[model samples]
Target: MQRVKPGDGRALKRFRWWQSLSRALFHLRLMDGDSGQTVYSVDVRHQQHSSSSGRVVAHLYLDGRHHAESTVPAVFPVQGGTVEVRASTVGLKRCHYVTAEGAEFQLVPDPASAEGRRARLDRSHPALSRCMGFLSGTVLVVGVVLLALQLAEQITRDPEGVAQYAGTLTSPIDLSGWANTVVGLCTVAASTERALRLRYNWLLDGAAG
Candidate 1:
């Protein structure tokens, strides 16, 4: 009969790395506003019956809700990278945008979230500037053509009102007025849109949109 030795190959550590199964790791991040986007992250590890000093993975919970058990992996697991999880505020009276684990990290610590908004006058100003250049060029071309046609028609025969009207509309004074007006209009529209969106975002996270 063969005799087994003490602490031999038959003896094994229950939580040994070799004996543990590979598990999916994860982390967490949360949003603090209406968009419910990710704002923060947490590190965690597998919830297995092993050494407490094993690999680290993230554990997640949505808005203080019991979304998962203690051993369940988070939505975005990461071994040595960043995790992304949203702070869900659904089914609450006036959702408070907050992470399930931490405080707010706003754009400047005023309230708790970033004001994802752009100044209207600043927003469409560039586009208007670019479009103004284009429209100016179009007007120049049309004006030149009209001027040439009018000159030819008048120089050879009786002149008509079409040339004058075309010239006036494409003139420097008219073009400048139109460009400025267009820029102002677009600036207003873009700025308003940015403001509205930002306000909605702020209501939840308590920051400027």
Candidate 2:
């Protein structure tokens, strides 16, 4: 990244709740270009949420100082590489700093954030993290299957020529209204939990969301 002098890293903005579960802050540390003794800091924020107005921005800092800012799908020039920040409908799916030499590393998460907590859990308890990951995936798979079956029923219920060829189909498992609501809620929770760990499967979590 271009070193923009010492004092530029001022007026750092505090985090906002609009960040939702999809927001994440990461830090990259590197040495300065001019003076080898100086250290530069890069901070990137990825925020994705349904509540947002569709604007995404990433901020860069030098020595804990604000240096520059750019919108998501952003690229920040750094010492030997660039930091790329990206987001998806539910959360960040990509946030990494890539070097000119092709080596890459993810930024460090802020200790206070939910993403940070999830990262900590992964580091401290790999087994538990794996179990939770598997559970989330299984939940999403169930949701996908149910949704597909329901859609199939809806498609075949109306008397149509296609139904004659395809054969009438009805969902074997029917859920009451309240049960449907509960399933919806559980699907949302499962997707959110998966997002916390930056785990996303387009067919599973995408459909669940």
Judged by TM-score, which candidate is best?
Answer: 2
lDDT of 1 by residue, 141-172 (tens): 44444445445555444235655454333222
Q: Per-residue CA lDDT of candidate 2, range 1-209, in tens? A: 23222335586555555554545666666666676643344344444222343556566776566877666666777778787766555666566779999997877766656777889999999999999988878877888998999999888877765587798798999999998888888888888787776667789877876
Best by lDDT: 2
Report the error of model 1 at residue 178, Å. 18
Candidate 2 ranges beyond 4 A from true positions: 1-10, 13-22, 32-53
RMSD values, in order shown = 23.0, 4.7
Candidates' TM-scores?
A: 0.17, 0.76
Q: lDDT of each structure?
A: 0.30, 0.70
Compute the lDDT of residue 166 as modeled in candidate 2: 90
